[model samples]
Target: MTHDTGLVITGLAKRYGDAAVFQAVDLNVAPGEFVAIVGESGVGKSSLLNCMAALDTWSEGRITHDGVDLGQLTEAQAAHWRREHLGFVFQAFHVLPHLDVAQNVALPLLLLNRPDPARVAQMLDAVGLQGLGERLPSQLSGGQLQRVAIARALVHKPRLILADEPTGNLDPRTAAQVMDVLVAQARQHGSSMVLVTHSEAAAARADRVLHLTAQGLQEPPQQAVSAPNP
Candidate 1:
């Protein structure tokens, strides 16, 4: 299996009114690689995600996928590119309260104008929500709601999955479960993933963890914890 469609960023910088949020952050991610970006607040983790996802413009730098300049695309084209190659999961889950789990999951497919009932079922099943499709987000527990979110994210089968603190809202147990599903499915489907997190637990699950600091990214040393008494 080969993925010639990985991500490349060069001199990526973001600034606002003379304030630098990110600077010269060069990163290259190969296909099917999972990378986690960790940073303290205001270090531009979210902003970086936005720029990579083509949700926001970078002040200076280039972002491309498979050598196609992502910035050069029109807004509509960027969004269309997302539908065809990107999936997102946020901390908020973002499931529509008004829609049932199935409908919520189907939203992306509908937006693609290629809704498939079988695809929806498959996504739900992948997230372990088989018969819960008819349940409402409010009726489900935090874990279940997040499962619905995962279902929605993969329903369209995009090539890149971008998750922003995906389990930030859930308890540690639920967070771990959601991460398990998220990681398993993306790898199983050959989708590259970039996740942002502050939790060491979450960061440990990534293929590689790169920290964002004043001087771009560095591989931080893992904290050594003493063993607990038996």
Candidate 2:
């Protein structure tokens, strides 16, 4: 099947042995759109995001981004694809402990062999970490570390962003700040974003909020209202 410039998952499913993690999952994230997935703990929201990133396997159906079929790529090919076109943010703020904040943010550009110090600086400023690039992750607060992760993920301007509970580790006020940065950067880059979170406040910022169940994704009963654009 043909797809335009966006993410498309069709009839996707994941399993281990006889247990099904989720099945019949279908989703489409348009370019520059922000989508949030929410579910109870152990319901595979993170698994679904991993599958979208091609970092994990799915049992059935297809996942495509900008017309490229992820399932058809080999492991090496998948790595290359991710390096070139994907940005990921994690709740754990997976910055390298040894690398200073700037170096950590620049890793993605370095991997693509297109390092741009200006771009790195721009990202740091955009995320409100303007002057802390020289500090180690250990020296920063939880919120600051998460901002570092956001800057790093967005440094290369990936077409798709997959964030798994990025604000889960922060206090409510910090989480809101992080979301503001994340949403602004995603908008600035015009990247499609798929965020999985348990926080209703985080999900409320999405263009569409869907609930993930073992059967598939569906609208929540109340249907989360998207926050107005700032």
How high a TM-score does candidate 1 get?
A: 0.93
List clashing residue pairs in candidate 1.
Answer: none
Which 10-residue window in model 1 sums to the lowest lDDT?
221-230
Task: List runs of model 2 lying over 4 Å from the truth.
Answer: 1-4, 223-230
Q: What is the C-alpha lDDT of each candidate?
A: 0.86, 0.92
| lDDT by residue for model 1 (67-165), tens | 668999999989888887888999888889999999999998999899899999988888989998888888999889888988888888778889999
The sequence of per-residue lDDT tens digits that candidate 2 reaches over residues 1-230 is 54457999999999898899999999989999999999889999988899999999999999999999999999998999899999999999988999999999999999999989999999999999998889999999999999999999999999999999999999988999999999998998899999999888899989999989877999887845445344
**Candidate 2 C-alpha RMSD relative to the actual structure:** 2.3
Residue 180, model 1, lDDT: 90
Lowest summed lDDT across 10 adjacent residues in model 2 is found at 221-230
